[model samples]
Target chain A: EPEVTQTPSHQVTQMGQEVILRCVPISNHLYFYWYRQILGQKVEFLVSFYNNEISEKSEIFDDQFSVERPDGSNFTLKIRSTKLEDSAMYFCASSEALGGYEQYFGPGTRLTVT
Target chain B: DQQVKQNSPSLSVQEGRISILNCDYTNSMFDYFLWYKKYPAEGPTFLISISSIKDKNEDGRFTVFLNKSAKHLSLHIVPSQPGDSAVYFCAAKLGGYGNKLVFGAGTILRVKS
Candidate 1:
């Protein structure tokens, strides 16, 4: 089965530095999303992208966070400036169709800030 | 306002027993519900899903029952095996396009032999 692929399984970044988390969703998927989970916390939705534009975003997805489909198959989430609170596992998900309930997720990128 | 809530932190069951995980929701606008399973250090894997219009959906040993009136849902795993142990999460999609998924805290299931 094809699955979403994320790069840099684990990242160690400095505070106030920029970090880009990359994901290559399933080749035929049309919708993509980014979600984060703090340690021992529930998964929180951050943003969703489609057709090269943001479809929906949460309050957690503020000015510092940006998502771009830099290419046809790759989706990227960029954090303008890392903060201590930015430390978490960021997951990327994709679906074959819109308005569908099932979304396959990637292994996730664990961002650790020191 | 957290929409989806899973009150149980963990559940342990004997092998070949029934394991039930429950969830509650505060939002009525959610039309779709999904359950996911996660092993340590891995992303969540989709388990089963139920729509607001249906009260039950089943697959293999897993069965999801949705109670629209009570704003509750439950996932039942019968004849549970050791491999069935994992953290289970119940997620909801607000409406119109699965844009975002609001997730619950999750329940850790341990099936012991």
Candidate 2:
């Protein structure tokens, strides 16, 4: 089955540096999302993107965070400044349809900021 | 505030036995529920989902039951196998176009032989 793929399975960045996580959602998927899970914590939603615009975002998705569909197939999340608390597993998901449809997730990119 | 809650941190079941994992949501606005399975170092895998309009949805050995009145849902795995061991997460979503998902803390399930 087709699945979402993310680049740089793991990333290590210095504090205050900018980091961009990339994802290639399923080719036919129309909606994309980014979520993060701190160690021993529940997965938290970051933002959702569709039609080249942000559809929804959580409080966790603050000024430092932004998402872009740089290309028709690539969805990227950029953090303007990485903080120590930013260390977590960032996941990318996509769905073919809206409302009650299953969203498929990528293996995830482990972001470590020191 | 945690809109979705999975009270059990973990569950252990013998092979071939039935394993039931429960979840509850405090948000009545959530009209869709989904269950995902995750192994170490992997992303959450979609197992099954149920709409608020329905009470039950079955897929092979996995079945999902939703009780709208109680704001509760459960995932049932029949004749569980060792490979079924993983962390199960219950997620809820609102009724809209491409809404964000609210996830529970997750329940670690171990199906032992």
Candidate 3:
């Protein structure tokens, strides 16, 4: 079974530095998404991407955050400046279609900002 | 946003027994519900899902029951095994082309052998 895969399973960066979390979604899926879970918190949606554009984003996905599908398979989330609170497990997910389709998730990248 | 709620923080069940995980959602517009299983150091794996148009959906030993009237759903794993132990998250999504999923805090299930 094909699965979503992410790079840099664990990332550590300075508080003011930048970080890019990369994901290669399932090849045939059309919609991609990013979600995060702060320790002990529920997984929260960050943004959704389709057709090389952002479909929707949450308040947490402010100016500091941006997503790009620079290539056919690569979907990346970049944080312009990391804050201590930004440390969390960032996950990437994709679905073949919207509405009733189930989104498949990647193993996640654990981003740690000190 | 508290749209989806999984009241139980954890559950323990003996091997070969049935494990029932419950979830609730306050949003009536949410037309789709899904359950995901997660192991340590891994992302959530899609387990099963049900649409609002149906009351139940099953695959193998896993069964999902939805009560639209009460806005509640449950995942039942029969004949549970130790490997089934993991954190289960209940997620809800509105019916649309690009709607995002709202996840609950997740319930930790331990299926002891």
Measured over the true interface residues after superposition, the C-alpha RMSD of each candidate is 1.2, 0.9, 0.9
* DockQ category of candidate 2: high
| Best of the candidates, DockQ | 3
Compute the TM-score of each model's chain A versus the native chain A and list the values.
0.97, 0.97, 0.97
Runs off by more than 4 Å, candidate 2? A98-100
lDDT of 3 by residue, B27-89 (tens): 999988999999999999999999999999999999999999999999999989999999999
What is model 3's DockQ versus the real complex? 0.85
A71-103: candidate 3 lDDT, tens digit per residue? 898999999999999999999999986353799
Which residue pairs in model 2 clash with each other? none
Measured against the true two-chain complex, the DockQ scores of the candidates, in the order shown, are: 0.77, 0.82, 0.85
Cα lDDT tens digits, model 2, B14-70, are: 999999999999999898899999999999999999988999999999999999889
Q: Residue pairs in steric clash, candidate 3?
A: none
Q: Model 1 Cα displacement at A46 (Å)?
A: 0.1
Q: Candidate 1 - CAPRI tier?
A: medium
lDDT of 1 by residue, A1-114 (tens): 899999989999999999999999999889999999999888999988877888899999999999998878889999999999999999999986745668899999999988
Candidate 2 lDDT over residue span A8-65, tens digit each: 8999999999999999999999989999999999999999888889988889999999
Deviation from native of the Cα of residue A113 in model 1, angstroms: 1.2
| Model 3 CA lDDT for position A58 | 92
